[model samples]
Target: MKLVVRRSVCFQGHQIPDQEAACQQSYGPDLEYRDLMRVTAIVICAALAGCQAVPGEGPLASAINEDAGRSPAEIGRVNAAVFDIVDVDNHTARLVSDYVSTALKRRFGIGGGPGRAVIGIGDQLKVTIFEAGADGLFSTNDSKQATIDVVVQPDGTAAIPYVGTVRFAGRTLEQARQEILASLKSKAVEPDVIIGMGDTPSRSVTVAGAVNRSAQIPLNLSGEQITDVIAKAGGPTSQPYESYVTLVRGKKTGTALLKSIVENPSENIYVQPGDQIFVTRDPRTFTLLGAVKSNSRIEFGANDLNLLEAVALGRGGNDETVNAKGYFLFRYEDPEVVLGLLGQRRFDELARKGMQPDKDGRYPIVYRFDMSHADSLLVGQTFPVKSRDVIYASRHPAVDLTKFLRVIGAPVGIAVQGAAISNNLSD
Candidate 1:
């Protein structure tokens, strides 16, 4: 049986006539037909969706999916820190929406209607006329960009033309308009005023740090967020891999992680005037131990240090006699962070067994060594050092003690002998 279709009229002056209305009114009778129709519609929607490309499935997918490729140098890392156009998509949408809303309110003369009283500032005003055609404050240029300077008196009223001095600063535009029109009945035939933003520069936020650039981002009716501020400053520099950013608002400061704050819309706090955003750099650090002039920490601007380079940085052993021997390198790098040149099989075996080598491997090895040997120098060159590595060097006990006696005891012996001879001559 063919389904009788009728349309019905819903709210807001929309018409749903005969066929549609009849179906709704008799849904009990048309239940099977309606069910079929709903199923058909869902199927059609699914078919359409199947035909369409999914997000990140098309040509642009490659670009979007590509991780900020491995940065080999500090310069490359810094370049990667720039925020892409896609990152600011939400900010763009919000700004457009807010600006459109502001424009609509202004165009429709919707001066915050009654019960929603607007606010006003010093020299601020709201001019309106119940009788119409009596709005006359500045009409010469008729330009919306009118500039008439007036002080907000101690009584909270501003001195204006025709109406003399009237309190308006703290009141909403509508409130000020009504109050002024009431007071102007004796002076002029009509009175109305419109309050607006002043010519003074609005409040802005400043972003600074390991960013490509830094600037003060302005605020319109459409506000911005921390991410927007970071983008404005050219994003965070990858050299430091800013795990989190810090924002200073007056005396108080808050820290936000890049991932958490960006992904969660609720936490994306609206930036305020005078807010300072600092994008931090990755804490650069390298480790040093073993036989070196300075067995301490070394820092880098970038994430890099060669095994030999780090040892050299540590002055590579103290006295000429104590050269680095059987150099041992300890690294805190990821277990999977592979080194291209290093023998992977050997390295992995050593890593898995937690076995470190000594000078001799035939029998129970005596791992300690004297730096005076020439072979130790070559060992120092090959042993690789990594981030946060500890280079431990076992010194030969005999060599250390002998060098110490030469360095200290001999000098004291000569001084004592000379003193005794002088005493004998004096006697």
Candidate 2:
């Protein structure tokens, strides 16, 4: 089939002047410069306006799968809900990272550090009685002192000779010793008493789960930290980042990453007797999605991962399509933590807008960090990436326009060229 190319295209029912003086003969060659400019502007504006309506190339599969990939048992983890997006900066990054509601030192400390060791049930105690002179009731002339074994019963009371049964479960060794000496003075010659620790089986920290050897490490007067107890149990069975140390003391339970305890000395808190130390393996990971080179779950190493390093682990965003400014990380943030990032003013604004944390005391939030800026790049290098966080790199807006232009640009260019040639011929 023969193809025909129309040199003179229709524009709002107007005829173009051909080389044979087509427009000059019919509608007169005066198309008016102002009218011409109006038409030109409309054409240019129409092309520019189409940029907004242009769509991206394709919806690629995410590095992190959604509900479709989750097992029925675990599918609840991919619940989709409306969330807030906050802009991240150096101040926000630092505060949100370091913020912890109950730090080890704050929760377990007494008098700026772990308090003096107190006698507890299963703590073995021995009392030594010293007489001023010769034997009275028990001490002979040959030996002026006598040692007696003391046992703390499950009822929180210890049975001792002369003293009978006294509450000693929570008392210090010195206090118990003083009580014994006072009780003995009434029955014997001027007496003094000293208390010393013996085999203490129940006065120990229980170290269980993901360790080389699960055991109950005995606590001494010197005291032992969580790390010390874990080390004694043959250390964690996993990497520091992958290991979790949970301390259950009575009704309170505190958990910290093994990596954090190693890096921050303050987090390596002292373990009290009867404290349950559970060394569990919980791998720290982040989901890399959107325009990244490799969209997959990335596991943390021995150290905490910075934003830049996390991105690097995903091979950063796809070079051509990634919008550097659209880099975002999704995480469930605490309310107080939101305050740190938003500041009082912005936080109040959100509160006024009826924004609140969920039942879990966490705000479903995403932090946007514009890597397009040199300063943000620097900040991202040091900004910490939390475990289970979701990182997304959006496609640039210009990418859509580029694709749209590639398909329609040639026709627009040809039309403009033909119009110019017709105008020159009319002149």
Candidate 3:
């Protein structure tokens, strides 16, 4: 329906006497006065209408639906190389929510029991020799026992007073003592030996990056796990979930979140000799885009973040602009996880529709969750927000109506003010 506005005429602050005759009277003698006012109203209306056109284009989901590929009709819809939109449901939420980080646990077995505590090359050891007779090698007439500090050489041997060079590397402290006793028995007078380990350079795990103190933590005879060494070096400087611990043992390396190690004890593996640990802060975050109140990148924080929590973090959707049914989460899903979840037949059908995998073997996917229904809300509560995920709140169809009314309102406001003035000169 065309917009119609009616209003009573007033002069300054008071209603004009004989309002009908006063409105009919001319404002000026200029023959061009009434025509100028009428032309101005038409110009303002056209400008406002043109301005609303871009913003009034329908909901974002409509645009995606228009360009959709013929992916498996059952496996959901795909927009080809751009993205794939899947309306999340209860069954899909159950399967996708099961996705957890097993990066460290899968590669390195969780059952990392106590490791060997053998003396390595370059280890420091204090050896003491005791003899029944005073006049003997490594002992004076005044003292029965003689103590010497020695380092395990790179060649896996240590030099002694009478034993020449003894190999201590790969031997337990007690075992090394026995070997030394045998060597001293042949030289020193009735000698007994004792060997003790000290702080060593080779048998230590180096802890650095995002820790209170970056240092080399010495391994004791008992055992030192990943957490033990991190605590010794003054723990992670950031939140446990935000902290990632990378363990480099020899040529192999494995990384796990500090939260994972604390929550799952089996993940806290024993540190080996010469192991290097790196503690880095990597906050898990997702981008909230499109018709949200505030477009931003928010952290997942110390716990798992769900779709509902993420929407709150994005300051919820703009009610005037966003659709109740159009929130989409964009992610490059691992083809293996998705294919396994979808089963081979459905995925094969999707591939046949020309929706190919990317260079990283990942499929570009968009998961749409309608917030209008109670079931969708419950399903969204279980759906997880992953790191680097993008959430786009699509525009509402009413946004076009809202903008169109705005354009109409501009012309209406002009008509209400000029109705009397324009009617007078037209006659």
Q: Is candidate 1 or candidate 3 better by lDDT?
A: 3
- Candidate 2, run of 10 with poorest lDDT: 60-69
Q: Model 3, range 295-411, lDDT digits (tens) per residue? A: 888888747889999999878998866776778887888775677556778677667777767764678777878788989878988998877898888775434433443443434
Per TM-score, the best of the predicted structures is 2
* lDDT tens readout by residue for model 2, 1-427: 1111122323345543323333222223665656555544444333334444456433312212232223334434333443456678887777777775445555566324566888877667787888877857657879888888777788978777677887887788888877777787789888888888897876688999999999878887878778888999999888888888888889977777788788877787777777898988988999998877998998877466899999899888899778666787878777778766667786665555445567556766677787868899778866788888988887654454344434443224423433443223222
Per-candidate local distance difference test: 0.43, 0.68, 0.72
> Against the true structure, what is every candidate's RMSD?
36.9, 10.0, 12.9
Which stretches of candidate 3 lie above 4 Å from their native place? Answer: 1-59, 62-87, 130-144, 184-192, 250-253, 333-336, 345-364, 397-427
Highest lDDT: which candidate?
3
Report clash pairs, candidate 2: 63-295
lDDT of 3: 0.72
Can you write out model 1's per-residue Cα lDDT over 336-427, one digit (the tens) per residue?
22222224674554334333332311111111222346654454344333334555443322233233223322223222323323222222
Select the stronger candidate by TM-score from 1 and 2: 2
